[model samples]
Target: MVEIKVKRHEPALIVPENPTKNETLELSDIDDQQGVRVQGAVIMSFKRRSNSIKGEDDPAKVIKEALAKTLHYYYPFAGRVRETGHHRKLVVDCNGEGVLFIEADANVTLNDIQTQIIPPCPLLDDLLFDVPGSTGIIDCPLLLFQVTRLTCGGHILAIRFNHTMCDMLGFMQFLYAMVELSRGAHKPSVMPVWQREVLCARDPPKVTYTHHEYEKGGDKSHEVMNKDESNIIVPGGFLFGPEEIKAIRNHLPSHLQHSYSTFELLCACVWKCRVKALQPDPEDTVQVSMTVSVRENNIILLPSGYYGNSFVSPAITTKAKNLMMSENSLLYALKLVKQSRNRANEEYVRSMMDLMVMEGRPKYKDHLSWMATNLTRKGLEFVDFGWGKPVYSGVPRGTSLVSTFTRFKNGKGQDVIAVVLCLPNEVLLRFQNELGKFVGDFSPLISPTSKL
Candidate 1:
């Protein structure tokens, strides 16, 4: 392992460039759900720039200033999160308290990191730097960012924020606004909105439809928090390039070849492979939880600027025997995946909010479940920070059974989807063998990139 270390300095707060809101804002029912109450982060690593204008050279200064200005419009991010009443719903105390900011220097350069900066990045903990007390949900900093300067003059930008404040897409909106300011734009193209009340439980809220993913208590499959001991877990990345995708399609009937999508295929294949590898009971329930967008139908229900947790995670399940069947198992899994995803319409969105309240706001459960969230189409790979686009952009920490999809390139210089998968060390090989039956050279676990 490469020895990469960072030396940190005192932390500070960056308030809005201009004070504006002082009233508290209630969090949307979706945002307040126990699944999203924790802290999460996104990482973007950039190489030194040769094109930056003077005064724009230091990333920390540029980003910090841009952040304060960006916060003026998105002030909720500059506030703290607190629960109200015995119900435990959350609200943003828009006290203009500012966000956490830190600057640091890394002993190694970007090149040194690129050598091993694949998904499940080894440098995540050191790069993000989770400060003390920052993780508390009450009155804690809603947003935190760290800019680490490398010996090569490049830097790594890491951001931590309370998920209750916003989901990944919502946070991306805030990020782009800051990037605009870094480019000296007078104002963000899209202003922020805080209409959490838009998603509040309806009067006399009723569940109407059952939420499988939010089912009350789980079974023994979820007994262990992390996936067994660390030594038994194998976290790695897999690329789904054109060849790999085509090979997968070969397994489907011609009539269904183009019916399924990349995202659907990914969930189906991973879930199936994982089930086969785990060798769970033949009748054991195996599920793939997908984060589907409610925003498509939510455009009318939710205004344009509303970006809080606007999606729903619908868990689709089948018997392990069904998924591991000798024939047509992939098709079976795809059907479930599609149906589950399609259920996240506007009505589903409203119903989910109502169900959470009815269930008294339950926390996240992981029994017999695997999470698959897609960021590939989000265009995060193209997010530029003036220094240039990052070679690596994502988070590597989460439940061992959870995976995220991001855009990446293959050895052929072609676009592909990179998925970060975590499996037991004993089953990883078995899992890959199962997946290989559907894919042809899905690229290597790590690809050579010179974005630096």
Candidate 2:
């Protein structure tokens, strides 16, 4: 593999000459008290046919033109990152490569693409990729595009973006635009709205209520509760095949009066197994932290299609040693998870938002270390980059135990959901071993002959 560093000229930091044509999107408002900006990547792969024809439309040229034209539709996206004193927005950076395209051999899979594409991009390497501490960007564009030929005679297009700019829904919109462009469409169905001021945090922001009370200074402040001591990280990340997941789900007895959602069940099982594999003391408390969207929260019902960091809630749950040892059932554990998630009310979300605004942007590390997010169903599959459809897509590393779940369409026209989790290396291996044992005992439940 050839490693090349292409140093392009830095663009002058100038706001676009035309105001009416440009849109302003805010990143600071959506972030939490800790400036630990969220980062994400979208992967889409296509199968190549040996008999396929390469036409007058050069793939690279088509992609460039498509991106340019699509940017005109989502014009706000083309703006470069800008920080002015305390305010920031997407401005025109004529010198920065706001969007980049890298070409690699077809043999690259999603994993290979992530490795090759992220290193060369300075923005990704320095600012976004697996950042250890929180240093949120008011406006940072680290979009990566990799086109690789596959050994199977097809090509793949992978796009990665910082989550601060857009959410799953907005990201899908951007992707759909790219797909439309790839198909030679001059315009997208809907143009992007980049009016950041319109969605700014409320004046004198009133939402300040926290579920968990914080005591300033003292031993309480330094306490690290509910930390996972697992040494093995699951391999193949946290993704589980449809059959494997289904089997695990079916293992849950239906006799329990209260049932749990598939998500709750799966998370509980993973946590339980990981804890067991790690052999943490029975007294060790295990907690699960997951993110929830705040766009619909009553304190701030963001306008429809408003993109930025509108998410706030990070719910967590802990189990005592006695309970974990006596009732080791997955169903019981899932019930606890369900109850914990239910604690995230409008007030909890609003409190975080208020803190973010009041703190005036605390350093990033002060926040990210304690939280783990589950982004399993962030609408990634719906994103079409115009290459038929993506076979698989997601971010595999960086955050602690971050997970993404997607439904895949198989040849038989059946939909199967897959869960991908990224855990520490040792934790992952323990998870795999536990999963192996679970699968050994529960294979029949997941087989085609078994009822779902």
As for candidate 1, its clashing pairs are none
lDDT of each: 0.77, 0.48
lDDT value for model 1: 0.77
lDDT of 2 by residue, 141-177 (tens): 4455555554444455556665656766667767677
- Model 2 residue 307 distance off true place after TM-score fit, in angstroms: 2.1
Q: Which candidate is the best by lDDT?
A: 1
lDDT of 2: 0.48
Of candidate 2, the 10-residue stretch with the lowest lDDT total is 443-452
The residue ranges of model 1 lying beyond 4 angstroms of the native Cα positions read 52-56, 217-221, 224-234, 297-300, 410-412, 440-452
